[model samples]
Target: MSSPEQWTRPEPGAGPAATAAQPSPEQVIAGLRATAEGGAELTQLLTPEGERQPSRFDPYLADIDDAALRGLYRDMVLVRRADRECNAMQRQGQLGIWVPLLGQEAAQVGSGRALKPQDMAFPSYREHGVAYTRGVDFRELLGIFRCTDHSAWDFREHGFHPYTIVIGNQVLNATGYAMGQKFEGKVGNTDPDGKPSGTDEATIVYFGDGATSQGDVHEGFVWAAVYDAPVVFFCQNNQWAISEPTERQSRLPLYQRARGYGFPGIRVDGNDVLACLAVTRWALDECRHGNGPVLIEAFTYRMDAHTTTDDPTRYRLSDEIEVWKHKDPIERVRVHLARTGGADQEFFDQVQADADAFAAELRDYCFNMPDPPPERIFSEVYAEPSAALDAQREEYLAYLSGFADGGEQ
Candidate 1:
């Protein structure tokens, strides 16, 4: 046995007493809410007021001219319109459910545009803007929401994997795929002139801050770190994971977690399209050079409910939503374009018209989409024919046939 003073552990820090130094619950909540402005670590090239900010990452955006910037703005507008249309359709019972990417257009489109043709992307469902950049037809996505198809686009053709509904599982898939790329010598290849040989490839996996707590995500991080896989872990930290706040998930910022896994971590203002493009370009370049894996925490906010089924008002304050509205991703780009004369009123009108047409096309496609045959589910279960599955399919069809004219027996 030791004396009380000898056995006592020292206070953790040099501040006041431990309890006195700690922040109250209200303070913590306030801090979490104030994070909408991001921190000093955040890499931003565009301000909420639509002013351009100089950054060390500017070199990565040397290729983005006025035309390209206008294109990015157009992409965000169309994506946002499509998202709103889908959400409305879901409410009207056209889609089974809709996952709206209302405030995340910049994060998805900027990073999506940064990808080369050979790169692969694994998305965690709400990456509609990315799908657009990957050459996936907007009409094809309607099939998934309408429940007429699992995924209509070919992954090999688009370099975009089918959406993963299971939280954080796509990270493991992307990691394994990246490891395969390394084993095949697809990364870090160079020509005799010390230039890229054009065979370099990388994989990017998208996840949410909430998924960081999942065991699968942790395991994926560890495996990627140990193997040095050319995978970029893109965490869209949209503040809330459903009803749970980011503060509840991790004490440290999400990007800081990469240091523990032995990789570089970057935090970018996800609402700034220019910054997202620049940071993603740098991260992809690192992966192509085999200096991966990197973690990017995109500081964004989700301005809509998690899905058509969620009611955000029950969990979050309207004041917080109003605060984020001032930082709307699409408006910033539009303002920048107008202020700088990068785009005129004609350009804005045309983009809005195009977005309206796009939404109309999506609505038409969803309304006219045909339902899949009941046996369609059994068809894709296996590569080779299975007798047991065939028998089960026949049994299911026969059972369905027992009803008269598709009505109850």
Candidate 2:
């Protein structure tokens, strides 16, 4: 059993010069001399250096041609650009707050792309990459954090749920949805031909390393396992749940927890987009075959603060941040694309230009989007109307009306 400390302990040699006074994230990571020593069943199709290896998942990539590969790259690039702009907006006081998914792009994008349009996804707040794959407009995402709307778009329209800010609770909701689909015979198709045979659906829920400790997450696991729900529990274990490390969260690797829940769990190199897509595809296939609910622990890292409000330097060492940068999800794919001739200078240039234009558009949208009307605060308090809320809304409105028209009325 690999301990939590083993899972998170900094790579060897923190470098002699590393000190509390002058911190260097780069030097701390470059000094490490460790290699891939041992692990439980972890799948890796793309190496950090952008090399491909033979794996059981090779067949899954048959349809992922060079053009498709370029598309995925484009997804990562644009999503990252949007995320960066949102973070900047928050810093500029345009947004209330922002959840930055700096290093977890591949894990979100790969799995999101694997999902069918009919399938549903439940997300924690930081799923910008998934939103991009779902064809969600960037402005819609801004509406949420800016407090202008409940959601950017209809959830069912994109099959992507509104972001759940309350941590792991969405796991149970996703499981219940999956179970309902199961009872309705909506499990994925088992046909030899890969077309949809029925309109039934599968569900996927995204949470983080911290949420695994929540009772709701565990209960969702239990119910899904017992009922054979066609759901994929995707946990991007990015090594920290706020300031607490995985070592403090569990005794062993998080994926191992699925074994106790009586289903198979697989760990994948979350930084490798190909591996993430392959593993998620395999799990979703199992769900369609009624052999579900599969748990996928995307072994990855969060290369930034948990949110814009967080000061990562206070909790984690600079060296620790540097170490994970080597395994960056976007860079690996870019390297592969360049080396394999999957994309050329023109393609790369176009992507950068597109990202810039997209970011500019997002900046304008966020700045121009109006604040929710005051009436919005009072609406939707209850199914009918609540006396207390109604009275409060009326009083607030009266106060506003008095100030209007130079206090004439």
**RMSD of each candidate relative to the true structure:** 5.4, 5.5
Write candidate 1's Cα lDDT for 199-233 as tens digits: 79999999998999999999999999999999999
Instruction: Score each candidate by Cα lDDT.
Output: 0.88, 0.83
Off by over 4 Å in 2: 1-40, 188-198, 380-392, 402-409
- List candidate 1 stretches off by more than 4 Å: 1-25, 406-409
- Cα lDDT tens digits, model 2, 198-268, are 55578889999999999999999999999999999999988879977665556566888999999998889
Backbone steric clashes in candidate 2, count: 2
Model 2 scores a TM of 0.87
TM-score of each: 0.93, 0.87
Query: Residue 378 of candidate 2: its Cα lDDT?
Result: 79
lDDT for predicted candidate 1 compared with the true structure = 0.88
- Pick out the ten consecutive residues of candidate 2 with the lowest summed lDDT: 29-38
